[model samples]
Target: MFSTREQKLLRYLMQTEKEMTGLELAGHLHITSRTIRSMIKNLTAILEEHGAEIIARHRKGYQLHIHDHSAFRSFLKIVAFERVNEQWIPSDPSDRIAFLIKRLLLSEDYIKLEMLADELYVSSSTVKNSLKEVRELLTKYELVVDSRPNYGLKVVGNELKMRFCIAEYVFNSAQKTTELVADPEMAAIRSIILKQTKRAGIQLSDIGLSNLVIHIAIACKRVLLHNYVSMLDEEIKNFEEQAEYLVSRQIVTDIEKSFNVTFPNSEVAYVTLHLLGTKMVSYRKASDALSPVNLVSEEILTLTANLIDQVENELQLGIHDDQELINGLGMHLKPAINRHYYGMNIRNPLLAEIKQKYPLAFDAGVVMSNALHDSLGVHINEDEIGYLALHIEAAMERKRLKPKTKRCVIVCATGVASSQLLYYKLKSAFESHLDIAGTMNLYELRNYPLESLDFIISTIPIYDDLSIPVVEVNTLLGNQDILHIEAYMVDHITLVLDYTDPELMYFQKDLQTREEVFDFFEAELTKLGRIPAGFKEAVIEREKVSPTCYGNLVAIPHPMRPLTKETFWSVLTLKKPIAWGDEMVQYICLLSVQKEYEDEMQKIYQFLVKVIETKALVDQLIKIERYADFEQVIKRMEEYGSR
Candidate 1:
């Protein structure tokens, strides 16, 4: 499956390729113009790598003008292996004798050849050939294949070692179909991932994407193996070095080739570091109770990932927040019973916090983890090491990030009373909690760089885009809302340390997801089959107050909208910019606010300004053919809120 990074780039290219200017490309890719230029150069080189050409013009940027696209397509067709591994159910009997050998290697206690053949979806003969191939494949490991007429086939060797061999064979065979589809989305994601890999000067597909996944998997597995290590000193040293090699190389390029996906070295090393962290966390105080070596057979590593997939059928859980599902997952692994006994619960709070605060990250991690779980028995959550790795990963988000310092930009219409009240109140709330960055008055909102402010609490209205998460409140700062704000402050205490710290919100995500405008409609109207709660009331309230029609057919629709620290925006199009009675509105924008505050109103105004700035981009949405692309436009508009 395409990774989030690859898929996002593909969608971006699909959206903006109509104009495809270097500037446009840079904007869509969220990269520097220089990076896009280098990407074009590297993209051209890779096309040439395949004996194709990427055509470019002065202003037009670049296009993959296939010299011979069909030639590359031909390279993807699978060549039938003569000695296909036993785990493979071959189509024909070219190596039928190898089937028993393959069967012998794979069968645990009994060689249930009939059962194996059925599971493989092959006839007994085809299964037989695969078995023969398995035997030949394992022969080099000093393994011999033998069968019992009563029990089925069995491989007599270092059983664990032979199992690893079988796993390697099965994994490679299964990934034979891992080529790009002609679908534009898949093509784009593939191109982005492959291109990034090549640009970093990493060999992607040549080494194979599966191999890369394996390499990383091995690194993760090594950590898992570390806790279970029972070998003599030499073996222990070898294990340590092998794990270190993955980190020191600063690249999982070899593994990337196997998957044709680019994984950053820093991220890879962090995985190692985090696994180490989790191992420390799980065994808190070393225990005298020791479990024997529960060997991670390559087959089990690869296979068990599938069997447990029955969880969907068994538990009837659809994936929403994967991290939450994963919090209790250590119970699943066969070898790591200690994890079942001790690991899952202790780290759950961190996972809960990660899921709450970093919603985007939480969602992505869950989806990818579950997707991998579904496809391969790669139970990432089972590896508590990966959990610690994510924390370290988030911790490593910024290089040389300033420590828990505060940058508070406070605002009130009249700076003396309400604004000062907010300032002092905020100071009381956060002074001991955060490194205060700075504060602001209503008039200064237009001048401060949004990123410079850590928090914005304003009374009355304000208009500059502060680039910080703005919290809108009332001027009086009453007891109820103060209680609410207190709850909010208490919930996000960790964010004071790291803005992106996943633990910032703890378990309060459910409460806040409701603040969203779309959700208000869905929960109140759609779900209850009842009259809407806040939205309809807002519309009536606005209509009663002389209609918020701003002449140009533009109007703001909102309920008393309640006081919220959140902002929401939605759009509508007129066949023509119509007049609201006497006034013409070429465009209309609306906001639901926490209170009638200058700072909150200003944020809505700034959002409009951005929409106007990107007028050209907004217009292109009219031409978009697909629902998916249209939805992407909405998502991109939301990202504007992030920036």
Candidate 2:
């Protein structure tokens, strides 16, 4: 695995398609030429293993070349595809405006546009103004539209880009967002602190305190994941444990499940217990070699020292561990003082996975790491450290659910207007709990049709011979029409997610391979009822904003809304390969959030990152066919989780 710095350099060379000198690469990656050479040598080995090689042209930097694009493209699927559409594809000032009025263009052909006008009750002309550059955009992609006196306008080519444009154009209303979205986490932390205060019989708000905790947590993850480039025996381990320890004490739960990992496997038990009992530094040496000394984030360590000092003076909360904090940041930040460009090398595997999963985050991490070094006297590899925090946070939100349905299809209007609204409505109705495949519109529902859909509901009535349950609504979205349908789905998904997969939650004693893992998770979801808003269709649409895949043979497919569960959950592992965008992912840990556990959602979120880290464990779980054995594994994990 290449370090983030190496990966960034590799991406730049691939994108630039030109020779970059060592000086330029060092400048871009923000590392010394000597470090650049080490990174290049390592990268060459990784690429060579995959039947590709990096060419070093004298003083010039290096270039990765492969004879085939397919493998490279496949690799891209695991990393590059995560940040595919974070940027807004814009218009050129010189381009011509071309508008197509849906009213004029089609009477029988349906392309719904109500969401765009939803807030404004948009008219055809208003849409035209917004789409002034539509024609120019289509032309740039080498598509042509033949226009005449009789036939006003028509799209003549480039089907993919046009369809993509149309799909994304109306998708803005779906409220799709990049997750670990900060807003919710902040709120959750605040609520927890308030509860803690209430328990302690104190009246303090601790408003900024939650942020401080989160920042410290992020910093600790960063140090463990990002090499400080200083001393060999790093002190980051203690910092990370401190962060987790603080969270555990304040929140009354492990960071992975947030609710407390009750039956943690041996490894989890060890880690959690170590954090509670010992300094994070010692835990690092004992748990994983790279883990210790890596926990100290330069900024967080320094800021933590300062904050503790202030708190000690004002609140009289006695904190004399200032030396530890100083030691943590003092060394980590100094070596990071001179970043060449993209920042230091990508030495951390977790950070590499994160960067591979989210390009924008990787880029932003680079910029932020360098800026923080310059401005705050804090130095660290931003992607490594920054995203390590992301992983920890994500792991906390993880929810392990079982296949709740036999099969089901969520019908919205061609994924627009009523369909779009109805989709999220049903998911919400189910409390965001359901084992769903993909959602579809009433029109092309059969085009990407599944052999089995246990149920279907829509505004329009349709009859089919397939024994598939159908609930017809008057319109796709709103009051009685949509609510009744959603209420039913909630029940179905609840049942499937809880009962069906419960048998498979145990850990298997045997090892799993790539193939056996494939057969599981290709099942269904029926309805239970009263789920959180925005569950299935809404979740699928959220995915439209960005592919849900987090790269590295894993993707956590979920809706934006939270769901309600019945306390117990069933985990369904796929036994067959399912295409997760550009790559194939063997596992997807579905979650069903039971209503009472809202405060502890962070635990499940954090567990997901752990799953990503331990791919081998996931592979082992996927290979088990017997639901009974799966239960054993879950039992093992649950037993060990409490530590």
Q: Which structure among the candidates has the greatest TM-score?
A: 1
- lDDT string for model 1 (1-643, tens) is 1122232343455344344666555444434456566655644554465545556677756554445767644522222232122233433343234334444543446667787677556678767656766667667565766667867766676532443444344333323322112234334434543444443333222223333333334333333333121235553444345333343233345435544555443334433332222221122112322222122334433433343243232222232223323332322232223223222111232543332233222323333345445564444441233343253234324311423444456666665665667667666755665534445666677776766555666665555554566667777776664555444342231221221121111111112111242344435333533334456655554344233333212334445333333334434333333334223333333344433233233334434434445546545543444435545665577655545
Estimate the TM-score for candidate 2: 0.26
Error of 1 at 82 (Å): 34
What's the CA error at residue 292 for candidate 2, in Å? 31
Each candidate: RMSD to true structure?
25.4, 29.0
Candidate 1 wrongly placed segments (more than 4 Å):
1-125, 136-407, 413-418, 428-439, 465-472, 479-643
TM-score of each: 0.27, 0.26
Q: Per-residue CA lDDT of candidate 2, range 281-333, in tens?
A: 22132233342145445554665455334323322212235354345433333
Count clashes in each candidate, considering only residues at least 3 apart in sequence or on different chains.
51, 96
Give the 10-residue window scoring lowest on summed lDDT in candidate 1: 499-508
